[model samples]
Target: MATVSMSVNGKLVSRDIDPRTLLVDFLREHLRLTGTHVGCDTTQCGCCTVHVDGKAMKSCTLLAIGLEGAQITTIEGLAKGQELHPMQAAFREHHGLQCGFCTPGMIMAAVDMVNRKGNHLDDQTIREELEGNICRCTGYHNIVKAIHSGAEAMGAAK
Candidate 1:
């Protein structure tokens, strides 16, 4: 076991965990932040995506022990009080989710994309960028729309 210290969702946390524990497991099992899903243990699935130091990362691909002192943000951290984040609101408004299993990761990835790409994300670019995030339902039509609108909203918010 190794001692790991990190900031999660604006809260400072330190824990003793197995050296090989994945970030997703650390978040879900240790911190009880189950919002970060584990759709696939492999990095191919984006269901385990989260923001680490303002950048999107596959939590399953990183070991918790290797991320000491890093700042992580899960889907649960995106909202403030009762208000939803712009990307989340856009997804809800556009009906971007169907089964909802991938919603959290999708939202996190979209937020990070918009944050990096700014508000000019076109449909083609959005679709291309979201290739990593697979949604078995919805065919990604509404997801693209939501990202478009969400990108605009995010820019406006800033």
Candidate 2:
């Protein structure tokens, strides 16, 4: 077993895990942060998206041992107590989800997009950025609207 230490959701955690453990498995199985789903373990789907050092990443594509000391943020980390993150609220208000399997990854990716590209995201940009995250249920119309509105709300909040 290899020992790895990282800050997850603002909390420092260290675990002794197998050298090949994926970040998604580490978060879900070890830490019980089930908010990060495992839709496609091969990274073809963005269902395992999370924030690694403030950037959106496919958790399933990363090994937990390689991320020692990194700051990781899963979907569970996006909220403040009872309050939802702007993207999450926007997803809800805009009806951006159906089966809800992809919502967490979508929200995480959206937040990272706004952080990197600034809050004024155009529909084209949003659509392009979201190419990695797949939501088969909603057909992406409402999802695009949510990200746009959420980006605006995020800008306003700032």
Candidate 3:
């Protein structure tokens, strides 16, 4: 087992895991951070998306040991002082979810999009950027609206 240390959900975490263990498995199984879902064994599903060093990344596509010392943020990290992040609030406000299985990843991706795109965002661009995130329940209409409105809300705070 390899010892890896990283910051998760604003907490410093260290664990001994297999070198080949995927970040998703480490988070879900070892760290008990089940907020990051596993939709497909393949990396195509954005359900395993998380923030590594403030950038959105697919946890399934990454090795746990490779992110040593990195600051990681999962859906559980989005809330601060019992307040939901703007993206999460937008998701709830816009009804961006249905079954809720994809909500975590969708929120993470939308947060990344808002942070990256800022106030200069468009519907088409948002849609194009969210291609990797698949939400089978909501038909994406509400998701796009959430992202657009979420971006505006976060930008306003900035």
Q: Over the stretch 1-158, how does candidate 2's per-residue lDDT look in tens digits?
A: 98999999999999999999999999999999999999978887799999999999999999999998999999999889999989899999999999999999999999999999998999999999998999989999999999999999999987
Clashes of each: 0, 0, 0
Please give the ranking of all candidate structures by lDDT, highest first, separated by commas.
2, 1, 3
Candidate number that wins on lDDT, 1 or 3: 1
Worst 10 residues of 2 by lDDT: 38-47
As for candidate 1, its clashing pairs are none
Cα-lDDT of candidate 3 = 0.90
| Worst 10-residue lDDT window, candidate 3 | 112-121
Per-prediction TM-score to the true structure, in the order listed: 0.98, 0.98, 0.96
TM-score of 2: 0.98
**Candidate 1 weakest lDDT stretch, 10 residues:** 111-120
Error of 3 at 54 (Å): 1.0
TM-score of 1: 0.98
Q: After superposition, how far is residue 34 of candidate 2 from its true place, in Å?
A: 0.1
Candidate 3: residue 34 Cα off by (Å):
0.6
C-alpha RMSD of each candidate structure in angstroms: 0.7, 0.7, 1.0
> In candidate 3, what are the lDDT values of residues 1-158, reduced to their tens digit?
98999999889999999999999999999999999999976877699999999999999999999999999999999888789888889899999989988889888988898777776679999899898888889999999898888888888877
- Candidate 3's displacement at residue 157, Å, is 1.8
lDDT of 1: 0.93
